[model samples]
Target chain A: MSTFYFIAFLSIFFSILVISAKNPVHSILYLILTFFTFTIHYILLNAQFLAIVNFIVYMGAILVLFLYTLMLINLNKESEPVKPFMVKIAGVFGGGILAVALASSLKLVAASNPVILKNPDLGLVKNLGKVLFNEFLLPFEVSSVLLLSAMVGAVLLATKDPKTA
Target chain B: MESLTNTIHAVPLNHYILLSAIIFSIGVVGVLIRRNAIVIFMSVELMLNAVNLLLTAFSVYRGDASGQVFVFFIMALAAAEVAVGLAIIVMIYRNTNSIDINVLNRLKW
Candidate 1:
């Protein structure tokens, strides 16, 4: 097998462990590994800018927040309860159906021809930065507004009850 | 025609598709099976990532930049999703000390 397949297998394996792990903290840590693998995949795909952003936003900021949240709710023991076996089986069935449907639809919907650019080395960051600033400017700014609103909303929710203080 | 076919067989699109399918299924399983809100959220991310993988594979097969652009948007959306999702999880945790999504049904009037 190729290195790509090896990395891909490792990514899938770690992500599965992430969801199945009982400890929330451990799950989050595993999720970091999952994100790292995604970054590798992005790099392989020549999306250099996205890989860096994944490292910074997901591994750096989001995982830190996950750890902080885990620390904040330090219960005496693990809090999430396990579901019954039947429910799990049902879940597997439901998820299976969805996956099959999605895959089939994509296959049926014939895609357009690939457009491999002659200059694949046009630095992703530079090109994306130009695109963001030029054509995608409005949407980019709107995203900032959306993020600020989410931040404010989170703070409001956190401080709603004085008793929790 | 035989020689052309032999040369074209080097890159298999099926491999990428199969891998994407597995990732998507894993995400779906996590969402359906787990009760923890965080894990479910992560599973959702997994599903999104799986879709992104499929998009990338298709883009490569077809030689399109648009698929990569779509992946870019998906990543932005995933970050936004995580921010909102984590906040909601925090709120749910404070209201009740458990992240078990099964109990979220009790929030109904």
Candidate 2:
């Protein structure tokens, strides 16, 4: 229980840092830390396959891509324009409203006692693989197609015609 | 492992809900406040992660694998999103030499 609290605290802190950091590189680093804490949370939930997948796909691929783009673009703190104070205040106000609404609504939800797992191996990769391949095969195949299309679309969008320019 | 689940259950499920809600709110604030396009993108990722966390919590509580499977789908979708989204952002930067979303106001016909 203490460990969950500690991990949750670290994740919330790092998420805040990801947004508030002046340097884009620093923000990316903080985002990685946030992902790490999330990975811990997944492990605690006994979703081992997902915990590893989250670590590899998020912290490994997506964040590295973000970092590379930031570096490639060479964005500096000085180059980032500042928003007005009113806008910042409004943002905070909007977020606070959402937080209050969500928190308050949660109180109405009666906490149901979680069913204790008879076979704790449900989240293990072997078990997940069976469930994924057998029950969710259609979505699994569809997502692969989605990924392929996304890759092709990204390449097409990013490439330039030198002659046109 | 059994003891671990017990300990986790000792803490009410509402705590996880509140935590994810707070994180989601922060992401919302970040998206609204940040001017840089990349930062806004990061905030979107933060929101997605918040949803993912909530899904995992529910999955654990119910002893269901479906929620976790959905999380896997969400991750895949997020990856696809980032790939295309960042590519578009890069293309925008190449065209205007700036990634500020405000600069794209020409589209606001």
Output the number of the TM-score-best candidate. 2
Candidate 2 docking quality: incorrect, acceptable, medium or high: medium
lDDT of 1 by residue, B1-109 (tens): 2332233233356656766787888888998899877778878878888788778666655655556666776777666667777778888887877877878897687
lDDT of 2 by residue, A15-127 (tens): 99988998888999999999999999888787899999999999999999999888878676356887899999999899999999999998788864543454588788898
Clashes of each: 6, 0
Model 1: colliding residue pairs: A113-B62, A114-B62, A114-B63, A114-B64, A115-B63, A115-B64
Recovered native contacts in candidate 2, as a fraction? Answer: 0.60
lDDT of 1 by residue, A1-165 (tens): 255677788988998798788887888889889889888766665666777877887789877877877787664486568899999989888877876876776677555333232346332777667656777678777877877887777777666577657
DockQ per model, Cα: 0.32, 0.69
Give the distance in Å from residue B83's predicted Cα in candidate 1 to where it truly belongs.
Answer: 2.6
Q: RMSD per prediction, one decimal?
A: 4.9, 1.5
Assess each prediction's global lDDT (C-alpha) against the native.
Answer: 0.72, 0.89
Q: Which pairs clash in model 2?
A: none
Please compute and give the TM-score of the first chain of candidate 1 against the native first chain: 0.85
TM-score between candidate 2 chain A and the true chain A = 0.93
